[model samples]
Target: MMCFCASAKNNDIIDVTRIQHYDTILKKLLYFIDYSKKYTIDDINDTLFSYTANTSPFNQKKLDANYFIKLTLANTGQQDSFLLYTGKAQRYKMYMCDSTGKKILLKNQVTKFSPGLFTNIPYAQIALKKGEQKVFYIALEINFYNWYLFDPVILRTADHAYFSFLHLLQPSRIYMAITIFFMGIMFCMFAYTFALFIRNPLWEYLHYSVAIFIFMVYFGLRLLNIFHFGSLYFLFYDLRYQGLQLLGHMLILLFILSFLKTKEKMPAFHKQVKALIYLQLIFLVVNLPLTYTNTYNYAANIAFDIMRVLGLLYSIYVSIYLIAKNKKKEARYLGAGSLLSIFMACLALYVDRWGNFDELLLRYSGISVLIFMAGVMSQMTLFLLALSYRLRMQEANRIRAVEQLQLENDRKELEKYKAIIDARDSERTRISQEIHDDIGSGLTSIRLLSEIAKVKNSESDKKELEKISATSNVLMDKMNEIIWTLNSRNDTLLNLITYLRHQIVEFFEPSNIILEINLPENVHDAPLSGNVRRNIILSVKEALHNIVKHSQASLVSVNFSFDKVFIISIKDNGVGFLHDKITDHTNGLRNMKERLTSIGGSCSISSNGGTNIELIIPLNTYPV
Candidate 1:
């Protein structure tokens, strides 16, 4: 929206006053004036200053103190409704009186400047000269109406025109009623929500405290219908209405900061917020003694304007920071609400400063509605933000409950697997002990008998006996290995690693292939469940067996390392077979991957120059 400008033929005055001296003149003129006092153009007599092309002073010869200035004002906005009544001789009555005084129009001996209903054009201007220097008190009343039931009148001087309106009873009452009733609802809602912040009772009290002051300000404005309380009602000794407005705004700022959890989001902003409130309170204390002192007002108002802009700018900065840092919904709500309120307030201040709204129809009402609506919008936005926060908390609780249920189910499944593994280990231990004591001993005895028979026999028989001894010895060794496989103590990670190292070296002792073993540091005495150790051992053994049997490798290396996860690599300088065929086998690679997966690990084989097998198992999966 653009700034409203006063349209006047004195273009030089309009330019200088509208741009530079506008706010200064308006503030000076308005601050000391009693807003409730009725006034006419004569009250601002212009006979002392003359309007001429050369801008000279008024000619004293034309001045007459006894004569009253006459001013005829017409609605420049819309004149079709009043055209018929124009150019007709008619009598008009005008008056000025406060809320308690008798009607001054009825007591007038003879009203000066009462031009008969326009027997000429729609507008007329007459200068009045009163002998006294004191400001005249009068009203400019126009006996005119529109379909909308507004009594539009205009106050006129030699230089400018202004409109006066009879205030609407319905729209004013409706807004006041809505504001009061909903404000009550807001209080209760705030109380309920505020109890949540009572852990820090200052915040709770701050919300309630601010709400009380705002309630009073709204109520006071509403009561203007019955009481002729002036605009500076709060600045007076017994009734400081502006103080209420100040307190209300300060509380609102506090409530928003606390509501959005800003203390945690931006600690420095929280400190500044406290300091600002304290500073406003100090200003209030100082203002109390200087209530009637006008000497410092110029500096004070300027300071006030500066602080308002800076404080609001600080709030905006904090909001941007919150949105960027946390991306929170509440921050967005507070930010948008604050911006709307500040903009409307600034616009209203501008209008009151330089707007000639008295010359227009329904414009002041539009501005009033904008201010009221801004408040309503801010309140509603904050309410929804609080509601949304409550909903999110409920959703989080539901998700946590679901996660807890899933964890319990997983625990039961883990216990089932553990029980089965323990039973299988016990059975394997019994079978391994039986084979080592019974079957291996029998094989050893049979081999010794065959060896003794060789000395008693002839050449051919002796050769056959020696062959039987060699066959029996080989059978005993195979049986011993089978027994150890059934009942082994290499169930922990440390024991399994040691056993695997010995077995690999022993298996390749008679072979021509060069074998290398690389064991990682910190591998010994690691915490591992028996089942996980068994799986790792089986997979490693299977891979080595494949290398020995199928792979025509000259050199082989096994390496292990572990941290968050354990890794083992078995590489061989052998002609690698196609991966598709190797992976499809039931006896070797496929079985190895199955064993690795059963223990929650993964296996992959890759080859460029030779074969490289990699196994990765989570250290956390091994019961650490």
Candidate 2:
């Protein structure tokens, strides 16, 4: 119980607009607890007679029964109106007493008490004349541990208290707005997490979403109840608010359990956690309405205290266990959040238990929940971060899996194509061997027979025999060329250059011409197909033959260069011919152009002091 007196002597009238602030808490007043709910103002003053000073903004204590408080106000010089406001009373009724000891009702009713919400705490305007004084008394019926702020304002008139009190309330209202803003943030997080739960259907997301929602519920209820918004006044003073707190704890525990994967990682610990949750649930069910069952119930308090201690221990144990098991990320988050939450909870419980010993701490009991709220929001935020990391990991794993499957399929298909190509190459080898060994040998034998016949024949038959010999030699050379093209070992560009060197050296050895072959030392082993190789080799042979037979050159040079296009340049120190002369059918230069064009290549011929020929082949003409 607490009361105050705010009376000052006035010598003369002052300006009506002049605002004065006063602190009434330092005065001595009388109060007593009426255990039987039967105390009148007269009975409390006469029988109890115990006076105490209310020298603080508020005083709080456990009122196990009815409590009675009294206050006095007087005007020694001028008649004035005074406003008195009380805050956060569970239940109270007020009556004013005169010097003659006549009592008059000033609040709700004499027989009933108002269960006050935050803003609706009862207040009254007391009018006093010069040298007049009055005493006001209230009987308080507390159903819970709460605070009483003895805030009284004396004014020249009653109307100025609203504006003044409104000004005084700005700080608390800002505090309330901050809490509501946090509530809105938590609401958005709840919506997002629930959406994640819908899409991914994970236990952690669902539990975290529910836990965040519970925080929003708790804050929103407090905000509404403080402002006396809607029907929150009734719920604020009822057992339902307690249920929300219980649910918040339960869901927080659930989130921890799911994220930790306790069943998979530590089965024994998981079972113990489940048992703890069950015990809390059972205790909550039994503890409801327990205050109404007894005048001063310690059963609920004892049970809750046990649960709170056990919960704190369990959270610490789980956090440490996770860290030891190498889940450091989850461990740190859980540990930080759990320690903060448990600390705040323990602080609140301690304040409830020991508030009667200290008015200053008890007065700020409502602010304690913000700490707990921050802890819960922090825990949920960490869980959200963990969930994001898990999802990214899953995505990366999925992409890796897809790449592995594609690689397997590609390997199998490549093997199949390789087998088919190898078989085709084998069949071509067989045909080349048959033509070279069988047809070529047969042609050589036919030439030998024709030559023998020519040696034995008369003059008229010698010509025919010689012609037969020449035709056989030509057919055998063509067969040998076919064999050269079909051989796999001769498919590389290096082999082509070697063969050209040998053929050109052999052909020009019987002539007066000198051959200079320039090839790159780092010659690429560019692969060539049978058709492309045959055309390129034949074209080079034709060019060399033309130079020896018609250009009459003494020196010839062949240069090969590689870039985006493969280049082969042939030059000779010979009498140069006109473009029309080289274009003649006998020169076979047109054949070279046609052969290069067939394989996405080109041929160029030029003449200055000597004959020069260029064969240009696109690197993409044949696969490397």
Candidate 3:
């Protein structure tokens, strides 16, 4: 058996002949802490250095300080060129020195550029000859506020370097492919849900669609950042992304509350969820300054992590509660989807945090992101199902409500018809009573007078004949008045005015009185009830009779004007009388006043400037 000798300590010369493709040089490295940032290549001595014992390849120790590394390589084989990869760093400087460490042959500075699929990994080419040795001094600057994974230092031959670079790129390529696929799914979901919101204008649908859009943007920016595709490189690794995440969470909570009607159905749980949402907002507000100023970053990160955990727990609890207590299939679907999503999300977070540093775990890192996306898609599908079910229920309720309203309308219409029929019967009874009280008695008296005239056949009988003729004329006039009142065709105010003008002219024709009429032009054909029209006409007739008999006025004027109230004024240029001196005409005036009052109208008589009679009728008080 052949025996091999290994280096006793780190910082020992590494033999390049023994180094294979993609070999890790971390175990053979030594580091020095530069607390003051004042260390130079000449100042870096072996006395100030320490071996990286039991340290991770990521070099996570003393993150607040800058680090310098010492490496020595010996070429004892036919290979004349090698490649050195120093992983990721904010900025670094490499010093190439002779074997004696007395003079620096070359100095190279490398700084991080925007990350990309094939760039951002810092590497250097090394040229060597047989039996040649070289020393390389590297200085690394790290920022404590940013979390980053520093990969192990790798050594490879020229031919194997390209393959090693491709190997390192495998995870990013897979992650990019998965991100693109999920992005498509998220866009489709957003479009569909947004269309639903537009169609229904429901707050729940709007919240869900907006939440989907926000998450889509978040994932899209993350994909772009990973590939370094755009100029928005600073947005991904800063407070903006965190702010976006918080906003997305808030929208999701709002969606849940609206979708489930939690305030109405689960008041206690609603309050708890509302409180959680408020706390998240507070954290979001507080984290901005902390992150921007690079102050209390660790504390802020811890608080955010706690909030996320609490949010996840609350979501799970509510979903489970709904599934257990509610019998709705929508609730069951939502609960199952929520639980699965939360599980996958938790797995994703855990894996992303720990997987990047381990070589074996790195292969699955991209899959974790895909798993989270899958969970989201599943949850979205279930939410849509629940929405469809709710829409169906709402449609059913709407149809029932419409049917009930139609039935109520039909009942009201029937009652209206009954009321109309009753009113018609009452009017007929009133007409019959009037005919019996007035017309029947007049006809009986006329018959008795005619019988008396036939028996006597003398001068007194002639007087009885004259009396019968006058009585017949009076009966005919009363019959005409009754017929006019009963006619439905004369129900308009215009018709009433026309009839009144004709009656006034006829009554004054026999008398030597001049009649002057004043009436409004273009009067609206407002409806007048039969009872109202009859009462008004009678009042006007009584006034005119008093003017012809008592006032003995040579000139009379009748004026008509209308607004919401109808006014009729009759004036006579005759000898005016005081109230005490008008005893003979008192009954006639009283009748006129009584007639106007019956139709919710008022009559005022004054003796000044001849007798003036004013009738005021409020049209609104009478029904059409």
Candidate 4:
């Protein structure tokens, strides 16, 4: 709305005609330093006021002191009112004087004037007629804590000033819009990372989310500082820049530590980063006191600048180490992102420091701020990628572990099956050998006796034929015993007991020995292997045969019971034999002992007035 190309000389009289619509009058004004803070309008004289060639006349000055400025205006055009604006100040007083140096208008304790919508500045309105001149005196005070490096004073026609303020707001509005967009993206990333932390409970996700939150708070305050929002103006301005920067750097350091698992993977580097973080915190705490007291402010700022640069460089170096030395896939993305962010951050800092050469560059090209935001966004995106990659790798490792465990189980199962098959083959070979040795020899003897009987046909031959009939019956009984042992269905302890009871009843029926059976009502019916069952049955049969042939017992008792083992006791009231007198030819006792031992069982024989044979079968020795 207003042009800013107008120029004026450093003279006491500012010709209003040369001021097209709006122009800075900083160079045309005379200034005086008030070290004692006792200066009044009456104390100000032409001799005390001095002109400076510096564009920013207040630069590098102590903000605690009062500054007095004088401007004289001459109206060479028609009658008009103009606005005298100071860009920013804590407080100021304006005095309007005539050519005689007598005050005509006095405004006391003026803080700010809003000449246009969204534009609030310290200003004074001066009225001038054709061929009229006025001298204005301004006493400016600045707060030490809220000092600016440059202060501009501008003069413009009232109507033009209003429109010029609107024109100046255009770039700020664009920048604010972009900032809001960036904040939105940051908020989304914060929510995403926070959600991830909630799900996985990993330190990296939590640290990243907190860092994003800090970034949001810093940027939000920055937005408030830019807009100079009503009540929070001082609060936003005070915390917007250096203090938040220190806090953000600390948070970023924490995020880096967690994201890289530095404590576990890089212990030495972890300690170095931790010390750097502590130093940043120390600087932040020290900076507050120095800034508030306006003591050592420049030195503190310089120190903070150096620390920030070093911290950023160290972070970049760590990222490079992870990428190159550690050879982490995720680190490559992180390193690339960090490099881009650091480069953009340095570029933004450079632009901010030097772009002050042009007022438009300082006001309109918020490109520096945008570039810095782009850097943050890029870093955040790559960090998310790194996190995703890490999670995927962890999931893949879990799956592989599960597959390995399953493979181990399958291998064990295959070995178990092989053992079972080998045991079955050994049992079959033993059965075949027994059939060949026992049954084959007996059948050959019967065939030879039948042939001899057919040739002789005498009484002796007939008697031999009857012997052949008895031998056939014993062979049939032995064949039935082998078949029963081979049957898998009889591989239970209950089945073995049932078959033994039937045989004991039949054996005693032909003898005068009274057999009394005692068996438990409740049997566990535990499983027994074929080898175990066959050995147990054969041992019991041998004991019974011994009882019948030699014991000469009038009464016999068989008792079956179970505890941790199966127990079978056979007691007889008979003429018991002495173990010392029994010869080595007593093969029945030796065979029974050997058979029981093969199945992890034991047999014991004891004699007092009678003989008792006991068989102990350990249940756990066989399948249960």
Predicted structure with the largest TM-score when compared to the true one: 2
* Inter-residue clash pairs, candidate 4: none
lDDT of 1 by residue, 1-624 (tens): 111122222321211112211111111111011122343333433222222231111122221122121222222232111111111122233333335533344243232232322112222222222221111123322111111111222223221111111222332444455555655665665565456446446563456445554654554453443222122332342224335656766777677676666689768878887887787777767754443344344344455555556656765665566556656676666666666666666665556444555434434233454354455446445644654575588689999999999888988888888787767767778887777678877878888888878777778898888888889877876566555555535455666677778878987899998989999777746556556766777788789888888779999998877767778899999998776675456677888889889988999999877899999887654652
Which portions of model 3 show Cα errors greater than 4 Å?
A: 1-11, 17-21, 35-41, 53-62, 77-81, 98-122, 145-147, 152-161, 172-179, 220-241, 263-269, 288-296, 324-332, 349-364, 367-371, 395-624
Q: Give a tens-digit lDDT track for model 4, residues 1-624.
A: 111122334467888867766676677787777656676667666667777776555544354556777778888887577776565434567787766768654754333455445446555667778898777887766555444523444455554445445545654776788889999999999999899989889888887898778778877766655445233366334345677766766776677788888899889988998998888788777775665544465565566567768877887886677678877888787777778788888787777666663545335337777777888788888888888898899999999999999999999998898688668756765776677678766776776767677577977677778677577767767777876777666778899889989989988998888999998999879888777887888888888888888888999999999988999999999999788987646799889888988888888899998899999998856752
Ranking by lDDT: 4, 3, 2, 1
Task: State the weakest 10-residue window (summed lDDT) of model 1.
Answer: 23-32
Q: What lDDT score belongs to each candidate, Candidate 1 first?
A: 0.53, 0.67, 0.71, 0.73
- Candidate 2 lDDT, 208-310, residue by residue in tens: 8987887787777666545441223553343645577777778877887787787898688889878878977887787766633434345655656677777
lDDT of candidate 4 at residue 225, scale 0 to 100: 54
Per-structure clash totals for the candidates = 8, 0, 0, 0
Residue-level lDDT of model 3, residues 1-624, one tens digit each, is: 111223335338888888666667777776676655566667667666656565352223334555777778888998887767654333456777764666363545332332334445455667779899877777665443232534454555554435444655554676777777878877887888789888878788898888778878877765654433122254235455577767877777777778888899989888987898898888888876665442365566667677778878988887788689878888777788788878877877777665554554235356666677777777777877787788889899999999999989998997897688457646755675677568866776786777677667877667768778677767767777776766656668899999999998899888889999998987767878778988888899888888877886899999999867899999999887888876545788778778888888899989986999999888656664
Q: Considering summed lDDT, which 10 consecutive residues are worst modelled in model 2?
A: 8-17
Reference-based TM-score of each model: 0.37, 0.80, 0.55, 0.59
Off by over 4 Å in 1: 1-171, 174-192, 195-240, 256-265, 292-306, 324-326, 359-366, 369-376, 379-387, 390-394, 409-624
Model 3 residue pairs with clashes: none
Order the candidate numbers by TM-score, best to worst: 2, 4, 3, 1
Residue 181 accuracy (lDDT) in model 3? 80
Report the Cα lDDT for residue 551, model 3: 83
- Answer with 1 or 2, whichever has the higher TM-score: 2
* Model 3 CA lDDT for position 19: 68
